[model samples]
Target: MHREKALDAGLHPEKIRVEADPYVPIAAARREILEGIVTQLRARGRVPRVCRYALAVGGQEPRHSLDAAAAFAVRQSWRIGVGQSYTDHHGAAESLTRPGWCLVRQQIRAGYADGVVVVTHSVVSPHIDAYKQQLNWFGAHFGFVALVVPEMQEWRP
Candidate 1:
């Protein structure tokens, strides 16, 4: 099914609150979370690990934003597995579900990390429920990290 169809058929979009603060910045929370995830992924190995993070940002400037984010991480000496896949105007994938799943799976494998952290620019949560299903299926087929979205307080380990 097309992304729009899948979403219209009942996919929950991403929900993020864009907090306003003079001391803080937009996407600051997201950047912090991404960096933290990258650090944790790096710590999993005895030696320096190749840390990669994916941002599934929709809209016109995904490449620009993703590149800047990746560059920031790279400056900190991360391996940085990066890629961008554009969604339709309705946040739907023009491609098939299988292909989308494959893209995510390939990225996960290439990163060789235990956990996957997904962030988005849209205030609305995007493709996570659907993405989680795909991740769960991929995990079953490959025996990877048992992906779980923990309760807010429980997310910190």
Candidate 2:
């Protein structure tokens, strides 16, 4: 801007410095971004605990989802307690027939888990309202729900 303005004003060459480096937009790493969110939540007392949380995996690929959630948590320096993992095999999240999902909520409600992590929103609910309701429940309990997804961070149910 300085160089541009000087040039526009027809200032002497000696009065101008080289143009500053061009701006470059660089997206943050997934771990860094997620850690920032967790830090903010902790500072605001929105996080149930510092590290302890649970996992909720629903759908046909239970193993895949579970691995994603676990790996994400580990990367974020989050911890999942023993037997804190739950899964609804080949089931629909909206159906609410997922015992695994129910157990995760139970753990949160009981204050045993600070939050729940999923591989995607579909692991929680496919419907917008349903997902919001789930988020509301977590908010009410001063807990959180995290999703493991691509770098885009644009994924939504």
lDDT of each: 0.38, 0.59
Off by over 4 Å in 1: 1-61, 81-90, 94-101, 110-128, 131-157
Best by lDDT: 2
Writing each residue's lDDT as its tens digit, candidate 1 over 11-65 gives: 5445443533321332343334444555665577622222222334354544443
Cα shift from native, residue 124, model 1 (Å): 10
lDDT of 2 by residue, 1-157 (tens): 7667867668664565564321111113223444555677668866323222223334244566677777877876677788887766544435255677777778877877777777655556656567667766766765677767532354433
Provide C-alpha RMSD values for all models, in order: 12.8, 11.2
The TM-scores of all predictions, comma-separated, are 0.35, 0.59
Please give the distance, in angstroms, between residue 58's alpha carbon in candidate 2 and its true position after superposition.
Answer: 12
* Poorest lDDT segment (10 consecutive residues) of candidate 1: 145-154
State the displacement of the C-alpha of residue 85, model 1, in Å, after optimal TM-score superposition: 7.9
